[model samples]
Target: MLSEVTATRYVTPLREGGSLPGIVEADDLGTYVMKFTGAGQGRKTLVAEVICGELGRRLGLRVPELVTMQLDPVIGLSEPDQEVQELLKASGGLNLGMDYLPGSLGFDAKAYQVSSAEAGRVVWFDALINNVDRSWRNPNLLVWGGELWLIDHGATMIWHHNWPTAQVSAAKAYNASDHALAPFGPDIASAAAALAPLVTEELLTEVAAEVPDEWLVDEPGYATTDELRRAYVEPLLARAATIHERITLDAPAEDKPSQAPGWLSERLAPRPRATKNDKDGGQ
Candidate 1:
């Protein structure tokens, strides 16, 4: 379980996220961005946040510290919005909180640069988690203290939504064609070589244990919470070994950028199939 804190105040809702998480002051005198279990996406979103955020942190990636927040419904009484009040009331118990990084700016490729080595680690981690939200349109990355930090992992590991086919979903290829880091020429091969061996069953088990039992209870097909936790571990362990091989960064023509190095730009550029006439020595 994560470090626990009690919410002392609800400051305001962060409208940027679809799930409507809010800023809160906790009893520990720390400010955090709290995600409500009562949100439409439900507890599973927080579950994913804990597992992925913690896993990323353990892998030497920068991730905000996470804590389990205990919320009291009365705190929302001061809020005027009916929707927000209801949401707070419904989420009266445990929720998720991420330490707020003050004054952090959203990542902008034009203003900041990422080394190919760093970019490869990020892209490879995203692939391992099967993240669909790290595309250029919504990078979900922040630049804090002049370093990159990963956040908002609620949308990763989509296979959990359908347990019966989780293995099948985990085995599918990851298309990084629209990935925010595609232009940086991520060295996927090197990343896989360095990180794959570290993603052991032991580490994954530790990560899974961070997810509270409340979230795993009553999962449709699983009889026990431990069973549900194991379900998450198996797929990720399998994906880590080979996901880099299937990564595709063939960006669409419209999204292609001219800033990449010649080698990377050529690799990311879509190629046309050679016609028979052209193949025959330009006959």
Candidate 2:
């Protein structure tokens, strides 16, 4: 369990985040981004942050540390001054703090032009988990300490609910022509081979264990932590090698700018786009 801290100081909101994460100094002298889970999307986002973020770390990817936080209600729903209160109300629960990446830039594939092998590994991992967040426009990658760190996995495994029938197939089929597509080949194959063994039932169970019970309760499709783990986490780990092989062989090698889809990119981007009516000269 994460420790509780009194909210004495307020950290500024991050311009890019949807949940409006704030920077705060914990009682333990650690700095973190306090993220409030607002209405509608609060619990799910937290679960994704914890489960996927932890799993990625286990798989040897760099992800920021996360901790549970409590926002002071007295602040009560204001921006800049009452920002913490507003965050608490919007999130529907207490606030969460993400470990801030000091002086780190968001992920830019162009910055990393690594070997096809490394790209292949990243692609395979993304594909295996059906990660739709890492796209051309808003690649949720960060550069810190001269390495690429993956972030914001709240959108992965959506296909599970969105496309229930879809399953890992022997046929490797994914759109690899995107500019951000990882270079695929034997290097990816070798990397997959090395990483395949790391994905196991125990690993999945451990990852699932980290998910809060609030996320697992009263859901018809996914009831109980173990069931959710079996349904979602287990399949990906089981098919890790196959999925990796498929993504490596099937994806195209191209260099493209990071741009997410229309709605998604709008949410993830540092700046919002003008509405169509605004563009059309509406008052």
Candidate 3:
């Protein structure tokens, strides 16, 4: 879908993003936040976003629309002079874009002042997906148009490799008492139920088709496009309910006050029996 474009213009870089996302203008004149695979992290990151973000949207979470764009290498790297081009070249040869949320400020839980019920739903969803990006220090929530918007899904489903055999504790550290854990259990269960039926072969093929070949060309592990689709996209959709139920059952209770109001730790706390080396890999 992104290949139909002829050109794109790179704008400014988003300083807050760890991956150095850039703001860019697409051929249609829409602005998006684009993350690059410059150093080889692009394919995985972009694939994760497409699969998970789409699934999240289906589950009724507020995620911005994601689309792939063919970066005009020259436009992205172009600067006032050749000096700027060299600088851009060293950064990355292509760019990605996220739909821009105008006039939005970085999310602060206190700003939304969401009820504990709302917070619970957010917590449950994060836990279900094993999202490790929304901790107190780096709560990647945004407030635009008077609502909460979740962003940066690069850290979800990190345990997809052994998901069938993996323990819940291996994925996230959810407990019943965590304030962000309870409100959404019922809703999450319902959402998962609805999502399960939608993960059909056609849907899987269609969405996987949306992923750019440039992103997957060299990833040996995903040898074929079908393998890539099944490995990365289909499971999440097919097992939506199972995964949802598992996370809801294991999610921390909502009795404890949120340590930082709007933020919840994306990483589970370490177990006493965990080896020193087992510390917080998901975070």
Candidate 4:
């Protein structure tokens, strides 16, 4: 279970996304980026964050610490934003909170160079979870302490939205052409050899358990939260075995044929070591 903290102060809204997640100070004196149950995406978004974020951590990926925040609607009474106030009023209990990374820079690919091995691992992990949000336009990645940290996993596991066809969706191929790490010539073969065996039933079961019961309560078609959890674990376990083969890294047709080959080859070509001051291209 995630550590729990009561929100002491709502600092400000991060208007970057539609969910309207905000920065808040907790009673434990820690700062977190809190995502609300009342946000348009609802508790399911929080569930995805926990499952994918924690799983990524266990798989040796860097992700900010996550906690369950106990929010009191009254904290928003002083807020001038009517929408935020209403959101708080509606989300008066448990919400998801990620430890705030101070002085983090958004990832900028053009400036920072990612090695093929690192890019392969990230692309493989994203494929396993069926994350559709980690695209070039909105990378949802940050650079803090000279490391890449993944965030905003609420867009993962789209099949969870419709249980009936989830199995079919789970079997579908992952199109990595638009993935943020695709340009780096991800070594999918190497990544699969290293990571696929790690995505076991036991591992996924443990990951699913990290999701708060409150978020899983009364999910349709499942009599209990544990049962609903199995629904999440099964697909991932099956997908992990063969997702590498299904990953399509082909460049999109919009790119001119001549330019696409040159661009990909250039990015993949061996280059001099990148300097520490080089830019990271993810925001």
TM-score of each: 0.90, 0.73, 0.68, 0.90
TM-score-based ranking:
4, 1, 2, 3
Q: List, residue by residue over 159-206, the lDDT tens digit for candidate 4.
A: 999999999999999888777777677888898999999999999999
Put down candidate 2 lDDT per residue, 4-115, tens digits, no spaces.
5655456566657665666777666778877666634556666667767777788887778767766665445444455555555555445566777888887654445445
Candidate of highest lDDT: 1
User: Against the hidden true structure, what lDDT does model 4 obtain?
Assistant: 0.89
Q: Ten-residue segment with the worst summed lDDT in candidate 4?
A: 254-263
- CA lDDT scores, all candidates in order: 0.90, 0.61, 0.58, 0.89
In order of lDDT, best first, we have: 1, 4, 2, 3
- Which structure is stronger by TM-score: 1 or 2? 1
Q: lDDT score, residue 35, model 2? A: 60
**Number of colliding residue pairs in each model:** 0, 17, 12, 8
RMSD for each model, in Å, please?
7.5, 10.1, 11.1, 7.2
Global CA lDDT of candidate 2, please?
A: 0.61
